[model samples]
Target: MYWIKLSKIYFHGFVAAMGVIAVQGCVLSTDLPDYKATLPKMADSWSSQLEYEVERSSIVSVSQTWFTPDFHQRISGFIVEGIKNNPELKSARARLEQQIAQYEVSESAFFPKIDLSGDGSRTKSSSKGPDGERIKSYENSFKAEARISWEIDVWGRLESESQASYSSLLQRQRDVEFAQLSVATRIVLQWIELIALEKQLDIARQEKSNLTEIVERTQDRYQQGVGSILDLRLVETDLANADSTLTSKVNEHSQAVRKLELILGRYPSGKIQSAKEFPKIVTDFSAGIPSDLLVNRPDLLIAEQKVIAAHHNLNAAKANRLPRLSLTQSTSYQNRKLSDLFDPYSLVTSIAGNIIQPLYDGGQRRAVVAQNKAIEDETIAEYVNTALKAFDEVENYLGNEIHLKKQEEELSRAALMAEQGQNLSRQKYYSGLIPILDLLQAQQRFFVSKSRLINIQKQRLLSRVNLYLALGGHNTPLQKIMQTDPEFSEDNRNL
Candidate 1:
């Protein structure tokens, strides 16, 4: 015991000396890497561009705009309303709450375990007396006691469990946040698509009106024998198609609008106002050194924490194989009558320490340790995979966004040329220089190009949303929630 105490004192002194040195070094501000300053020039440049665009971008206050205008229902804001109103998001949040509850329950293990118990009973007995006679007696007995039992976490197993649970709670919270981002991105993408469809329908309507005028002019020329019978027939066919195309496009637009509304927790209304322009985003981003990413990404951090928790769990399993020390004791005064139960003369006290070692358990304990070891291994593998996946997602989104922007520009030019062709063909046919078939061909080309353009724009917007999610967009939604939540009020104190 003396030698152990001496060794412990020596270890403590060494640790204290090291701690003092560490504190002194920390005070000196040992030239740690200037992380924010050294942030990738690409990220800084892109962030500046993004901020510029966001500042210039048309702002619509979703707060005032009814999500379902016909229904007179409006969502509060994109951040809080988005999470609370989304069912999938709510489910994820509930899981977060469960983990938090588990953390609280596990935390209780850190405190002493005590019980207060009471019981009442009646019994009848038969016994042989000195005269060989059996007798029965009735009595009511009552007992009450306060019991206290404690297992001192001398080796810190309990503390490790509590820590593991805490990490799990944090991980769950991050998961809920991630889920919120995913839902928001989906809603935004669908909204963009619906708006694109609206624009597409408008384009279709304009083309239809233009074709109707061309058709009427061609028919008049045919009546005067300036246009051929074939030309007139071809114009009639295109006129019919224009009507059909308009209806089809309108239907398509309604479908997309409905889906977006569903995501916003509403029924689709044809009258929902879509923004005239799409949100602009900057895609240029570069992740810094490999070492810099671990703390920056939440999902990666969560996976790493899980691995750490698993390792601690395995250690706890091993600790279970060793005998645990518990001290249990109780003091009580009891009698058949309540009046006598409080007597000091009737008091009883006992104290004892317990030790139980596994003699044999059909190898159950061994199997448990092995299983825990395997789980730890799996967690480590998951940690590695999750890290790699996060890195890959960021890189992929960045590259794709850059390429998609160029594609959008090219498609826009093609759509413009098609529109020009439709105009030229119409004038040529009216002058009797070309058949009506030529005009219809020009119209088809215009329709195809315009459709392609709309799709590309939608794709571009969605790509940005994907990139935002991959790069772990700022948790602005959470901040917005904090500002307005009633629970944050000073009057809502824990008391």
Candidate 2:
């Protein structure tokens, strides 16, 4: 009979709770908007085609064209070392991991939360009976209970939040990849700069030696009464200039080494070895279509992911302006006797449902929706800008490759002619056919042309590196270029 009565009471409580939920459901209304239609669309292709040409051709492959075998090996090693040790890349990876954890946290909202609790209490009371007699009472109670609660996502609020978090996780992952690419590109460029500086130092030393020899010869001619003191002074001044230039080049080379070492995550000891000469790279830059950049570039991909995340955020914000339903159930066993707490007769259970409809919040919910929409628009603009910038960079580097090659060729011819002229002028000065001023002019022109040619060569190599970076480091095109080059023999390895 007692068990029957307890069952009736529990059934009544459940019925009452259902009645309350049904009543509230009829009165509450949701104000959420359809957010899917608000998402922005992206372009399927580039706005413009890559129009730069090389060797009178509109299309070229840059992948291995400028990457010589030695350059490929050295830069590959540096990139590997830098990716392993760069602190900025490591930090980006750490942030990715954190976002992964946050994604899981957001996903947890889809499931119910359960809690277990237990408590024991003893109470004593003293009071006077109706007949003026003193009376005392003591009581002991023990209880154990399990409670479960869940927020029903009837309007897809939790689902939208989970999607947003997942997009954020993907964005963070792209950020890490972008960091890796950036670190590798920086290492390669710094390494190239250091090598070019070393070549400049060599050129300066050679020029210094040549000027010293010229000054000695002029002094000898002055002692023999064939050269004026003014002529000897002119040669001495040139020698001093060469010495000062050599000293500056040496300092620059040292600094370049230190910069490269820092990028490699090594101590800036300035002891790194560099190539003795600039690698002979191909003049042709193989730039495929501009559309390839959208798929290949990490930064662009990251921007796209941000837009996705923002779209999800906007959905979640719109969903927040609606009614939320939550259900909770608790069951407990209670008994004065501690061991009898687990008895079926002592059990009690109750269930409840709550619906929260925001009547007023001073327009906070509307502001949140507007803010997320604005953020989505901002990310879209940034993505479009990134794509345009990438295309501009590709065009700039391709044009640079063509113009730099022509400059290098013209300068090479000038350097050769200047060398021959300097030699002939020296011979003529010894034979008393030309003045010392003429010889000095020829020597100065030769040194300047040679120095300029070396610098142009270095610039060409640097431009190739920039093209590699702008193309998102895709190297298959480069391999094809390397295979077609006559200089790439069986012994030459691809970068």
Candidate 3:
């Protein structure tokens, strides 16, 4: 009983001494490094020419819904299905969940660890008394103990670990958002291409029908000795080429449909139907300042998160080289009878504290700190590289829109003139006023001009889609989705 009292006094003194040591460690430990110092300078305005002045808005404002009710209805349906079922997006979400679980595991380090254990043993011994008489004795013992251990984060090592995990989780969230945006953009492009192929097929079919009529008329004239064999053969050749062009267009359309189906996580059956007509693109959306990309673009945000994670990891590595304080407490009971193992009178309690300064470890801790610093630098460089690439994409797409509009206008005029020439040549050939070669050339020009016009129109639509993507357009309410979680709400507020 006197020993128990004495132990209590010693435990209190030990706690007091450890508190002083912990305070000293805190004073000697430095605060985390400024992570923002690693970032590159951001441009105030985009290098690309904008039709309107740059508008600085909230991140939510930047997520303009690109698809509207008046926009192609079938395309909207396909986008919905694709977003719900895309395998890549599903995997991204799963990774986000994994990061969440990992963050929770890292956060658990802040709490103490507890364990319970028990044991029972029986022993028998035979011995000889001083008179050489044989003596037999048996003893039974049972014991149970509960123990707890906790590490005091004097140098903020645990805080840094938790921060790293949180940053990683944020990175995964941005990845999922970017994946969703990519999938939707891909589906829209495929659907647009498929519609373009259908338009081209219509032109091919019309060309074939006109050539078929010309061939029939030439054959009749030849039978009556009015048309030469050369003329008849030339017409047949044009007819055959028209048939080949029509067949190729059909195949291209089929492939485009199958590609779209694959994006929707469906079998590539080529059975998915596209919109009857190409979706019209609204070209008037504003492209915000380049600085907005840091907040609006998910991929950019993801890169920034990587830098944050690396900074925290470096801090944790540095703190690992400092002194660590740990405390332990244990309670135990022992009795010869198992039923009395928990008796109050038989219980013992003890408390202990220790500090580990890591005096020497063959330079292992220093190497770890160096490695983390290098990693931090690598992430910073990668972030700058990613930002530069994003700027290039936006500029290129914006410049392309201007040139594409000019091309579309000129192609439309060219197609109209070629159509008129083909009609006049057909009438002249049938009236014996023009040679077969002249008519064939006119038809070829008409077909080529029409095909070019259709393709340019498709390109313009695709350009709009690309421009929207480059500007960080979102098809869903990303802010609402993020705000559903309390931690993400804080992030949004900070953004």
Q: Taking the tens digit of each residue's C-alpha lDDT, what string does model 1 give over 209-323?
A: 8778877887788788787788777767777887898899888877776766666666557555655555554223333334434665668767767876776676666556555
Expressed as tens digits, the lDDT of each residue in 1-495 for candidate 3 is 999999999999978866765664463223444544555675666555544433445222334544444554456566667766889878988898899999999999999999999999999999999999999999999999999999998788899889989999999988877886788789878877988998998899999999999999899889999899999999998899899999998999898988999999999999976666765543345567787776778888888888888888888887887778899999999999998888998899999997887779999988998898899788878877887888888888877767787899999999999999999999999998999899999999999999999989998888777877776664332333333445545533542
Model 2 clash number: 5
Alpha carbon lDDT at 38, candidate 3 = 55
Ranking 1 against 2 by TM-score, winner? 2
Candidate 1 wrong stretches, greater than 4 Å:
1-76, 122-140, 267-271, 281-293, 475-495
- Candidate 2: segments with Cα more than 4 A from true spot: 1-66, 124-139, 283-285, 475-495
Candidate 2 to truth, TM: 0.81
TM-score of 1: 0.76
Compared with the true structure, what per-residue lDDT tens digits does model 2 show for residues 1-495?
999999999999978865765564443223333332333443453223233433456344555355667667666667666766788877887898899899999999999999999999999999999999989999999999999999998667788789879988888877876776677778767877777778778778888888788888889989999889999998899889888999999888888888877777889998988878777774454466677787888787887778777877887787687778899999999999898999999999999998787769999998998899899888888877887788788778777777888899999999999999999999999888999899989988998898899889878878877777788766643333333444432323311
For each candidate, give its TM-score against the true structure: 0.76, 0.81, 0.85
lDDT at position 426, candidate 1: 77
